[model samples]
Target chain A: MNNSEISEQGKLTIVGTGPGTDQLLAPAAKQALLEADSVIGYKTYVDLIRHILPESCDIQAYGMRQEVERSRAAAALALEGKKVCIVSGGDAGVFSIAGPVLEVISEEDLEKLNLSIIPGITSALSSAALLGAPLIHDFAVISLSDLLTPTELIEKRLSLAAEGDFVVVLYNPASKKRTELIKKCAQIMIEAGRKDTPVGIVRHGFRADQNVTVTTVSEMLNHDIDMNTTVVIGNSRTYRKGRFMVTPRGYAL
Target chain B: MNNSEISEQGKLTIVGTGPGTDQLLAPAAKQALLEADSVIGYKTYVDLIRHILPESCDIQAYGMRQEVERSRAAAALALEGKKVCIVSGGDAGVFSIAGPVLEVISEEDLEKLNLSIIPGITSALSSAALLGAPLIHDFAVISLSDLLTPTELIEKRLSLAAEGDFVVVLYNPASKKRTELIKKCAQIMIEAGRKDTPVGIVRHGFRADQNVTVTTVSEMLNHDIDMNTTVVIGNSRTYRKGRFMVTPRGYAL
Candidate 1:
C-alpha cells in the first residue's frame, strides 16, 4: 500500500491529451502514452492522438457511453500486471475517464493498483484561450448533460452562478437528442439579470473546423452550437474588445 | 484589423506554464517560448521555465504584484515588431497574466498586435489529479485572495457553491498577511451544510516538494496551507477512498 509497493505492481494511468491537438498535449501526457504498454479510450479521442501513440502498444477502442465496460477492462488489465492507460480528450479529472477508472477499482484493490492521473488543458481553458480570456475572474464549470445529473440541479446551479456573478463555462451544450437544456440554461441566465452579459462560444476548439464567436447572452441562440461546443457566459465586467472577448482582472489601469 | 493584416505584425502570446514543472507544460507553450523574441513575466513564473527558454529571447522579470506595469512593457515590445511572450504560472487565463495583458492592448493597437493565448493545465486540474478525481462533476473555482476582488463577493461564491453541492476549488487559499479569508471560506462552507464534506489539499502541486492530503471540511483548518496550496472541497457525494479522494459521476454500477 506504500509508494514503493505500488511501484512494484502494475500501474494504471489516466492521461488527458488536451483538445485533440498534438501541440496542446502536455509533455507528461505524451510521456505516459509513449511509455504505455496498452492504451484504451473512446474511438474519437483515441483517433485524436493516433499519430503520437507508440506502435508497439496495444490499442482498444470503445463505443461512446460504454465507460463502465471500458473502465472494468482497463482495470482488469492492470490487475494482471500490464501497464494500462486510459486516455481522455481533455483533462482526465474534468468530466473524463478519471472518475470512471477510479470508480471501477474496488475498495480492496485500491491499494493494489498503482494509479496515476495526469492533467491536461481542458476544453474550458482552450475555449477561453481562443476567445481571449473570458475566465480571468471567478468561474463555474457546469455540464448540461442530464443523463448523469438532474436538470433541476443544473438550473439551480446556473441561477446561483449568475447571482454570484461568476463567469460560467458549459460543457455538452447541445446534441441531436438534447437541445432543450441549453435553451433552458440561456433562459435562466437571462432571467437572472445577465441578459447583456458577453458570451463566447468555441466549437471544435483547437481543431480544424474550429468556430469562435462573441455574442451577448440574449443572442447566443443564433450561433451554431452542437455537442462539440463550449459556451462561456461572461461575468458582469466581461466585454468585447475588437475581435477578442475580455474580462478584466480589476486593475486600476 | 483584419486577420491577414494582424498576422503581418508583431504578435504577443500569453503562455501558461502549468504548475512550475517542465513535464506539465504544454507543447504549444514551450513552442511559443522557443520562438519568442522576448519573454516577460513575474520572477517566480519566469524562473519556472527559464531553462526551457531559448538563449536568444530577451528576458524581462518583474516584481510581484506588478501586473499592470509588466503587461504594458510586454505590449510595447510586441508593438515594436517583436515576438513577445508573457508567461503565467498556471493557465494564463485563470486568474493570471492573460487579463492584464489583454487589458493593456488598446483597440487602436489591437489590430497592430497579433495576440495568441495558449492554454496550460491550471493548478486546480493539477491539484485534482494529485488527490484523485475530486472535480469529475460540476464545480466552481474561486480565489481566496481579496486584493483584487472584495471579501464579500468571495464569501457569496463560497456559499453559493456549497448550496448547489458543486465541488469548489480554492486558489491562493492562505498567505502570511491574508490568512483570515481562507478560514472564513471554510466557515462559510460548513455553515452551508458542508460540515463533514471531503476536502483535498495539494500544495506545491507537480513539484519536488508536493504534498497531498484528504480531510474533511470541518478539519481542513488543522492542516498547513499557504499561497502555494490549492484546496479542493468535495461535493455531497465525494468521499475518501484510502489515500485518494474521489467524487463519483453518478454512474450506475
Candidate 2:
C-alpha cells in the first residue's frame, strides 16, 4: 500500500525516529509524526522531536519501563478513531518498540486497525557512519541489557560472534547494574584472538553532545562507556586509518 | 564538527539513498544531494533517484563491478573543486560504497576535502518493517555472497549465529552462481535445533513491487528466493501471529 495514502478512519503508525536527530529522521517518519493526531513514546524520545510536532497533536510521554502501557494507550487511541503514532528512538525493528506494540494488539483488532511501520536508520547505522565503515562486512548487533535477556545468552552470543569473526555492534553495553558486561564482551573478543582489533565507541551519536573514540578490544576497558554508548568491535580485517575505523568490503583490491 | 557547517571549498559527500524509495531517504541525505555539484553511483541506483535530482547536477552512472572506479572519479571531481555526492542504494555503510570511497582518499587529500557520510535505511530495516517486528532482539546480518568472503567462512558464521540463537538477516542469499548457499544455511540452522523457527523472505521490500512471505525454517527451501530477497531467520522465540512475524522483546508480561 502507498504510505502516503492515508485512510479516512483512525490508524496506528509506528515511526522509527532514527537516532534522535531531526536531520536523521526519514521523510516517511517525519510525515507520520506530522499527521499524527496523538503521539505516544518514551519521555526522552518525545522530547527529542517535541519542537517539530504540531500543537494539535496530543502528546503522551511515559517514563522508562512503561513501554507496554504506552503501546496499549496508542492502540486504544487508534481504536477510538484517532491517528496514533508510536515513536521509537531507532529503527522500530531493532531492539525498539515495534514488538511491544504488536504484542498489545489483538487478532480482532488487526482487521479494524490500519497498522504501518515506517523504517528509520538504526543506531548501529548511525554510529557506523560516524566511525566511517566499520560494518562494511558481516556483523552482529547484540544488546548487553540483562534486564530482558539472560546474561548467559548475551555472553554466548558474544563468543559466537567473535569466533565467527563478524563485526559486532553492542548496544546498552553498560548501565548502573550492568557495568561489567562490556568488559566481559571485550574479554571474549580478546580470548578469540581479536586483542588488537579496533573498537569504535560512540556516545549520543549524531547529536550535539556526541563523543567518538577509537580503541581496541584489549584497551576497551580503559574507555568510559555507558548505556548511552554504542560500541562497534571490528572484525580481524577492521583497522584504524587516521581517525576513522574502516572494514573493507572484501573487493579483490 | 557540526554537519551543518558547510565549508566554502568543494567536498565529497556520501549519500545513502534508502532502499530506492524517495520517502525512505533521510532529510540530511536529500539536502546533500540537492546541493551537490555532481552525483556518482551505480546505474540502477542513479536511475532510482533520477527524477528527484536537480537539473544542474551532473549525473555519472557506472555499471556493476566498477565501484572502485566510480568512487575514484567522484573523489577526483571533489578535489577539482566540485561538490560531489556519491550515492549508495541503501545505507552507504552496509555492504555498499562507503568503504571504497574511504579507501581511495589519500592523506594529503583528506586535509583539503570535506568528507561526510549520510546514513540511510538499509534494506534489512526496510524488509523487517515490511515483514513486521522480526528483529526486536539481538540479531546478526551476514551477506551470503561468496565473491569477496570465502563460502567456508560464511558457513561458519551462519552456524555460530544459529548455535547462539541469534536472529539472522541474510543478504545476497542467491545469484546465478550462488543458488546452493541459502540451502546450506538452512541445513546449518536445522542442525542447530532451529528446525521450527520462523523465516521471513522479503523482495524489493519498500519498492513498488514489494513482496513479503512468512514461513517456517522447514518450509523456507520451498519458497522462491533470489539475490533480491532479504531473508530473516527468526530465533526460538519468533512466531507468526497472522501475517506478521514477531520476536518478543522478552518482557516479563
* TM-score, first chain, each model: 0.95, 0.95
lDDT per residue (tens digit) for residues B130-238 in model 2: 8889999999999999888888999999989999999999999998778989999999988988889999999988889988999989899899899788999999999
The positional error of residue B115 in candidate 1, measured at the CA in angstroms, is 0.9
* Per-model B-chain TM-score: 0.95, 0.95
lDDT of 1 by residue, B1-253 (tens): 7997655578889999898998988888898999999999999889989998888879999999999999999999889888999999989999989998889889989887778899998999999999899999999999998998989999889888888989999988999999998888888888888889899989889999999989999999999999889999999899888888889998997
Task: Supply candidate 2's per-residue lDDT for B137.
Answer: 93
Can you write out model 1's per-residue Cα lDDT over A1-253, one digit (the tens) per residue?
Answer: 6997656578789998899888898888888898888899999999998888788999998899999898999999888888888998999899888998888888888788888899988999999999998998999999998899888999899989988999999998989999998899889888888889899999888999889999999999999888889999999889989888899889999
Q: First chain of model 2: TM-score? A: 0.95
Docking quality of model 1: it rates as high
Per-residue alpha-carbon lDDT of model 2 for A18-136, expressed as tens digits? 88888989888988999999999998889999999999999998999988888889999998889999998989879989999888889789778889999888889999999998989
Worst 10 residues of 1 chain B by lDDT: B1-10
Give me the runs in candidate 1 sitting further than 4 Å from their true place: A1-8, B1-8
Tell me the spans in candidate 2 whose CA falls farther than 4 Å from its real position: A1-8, B1-8
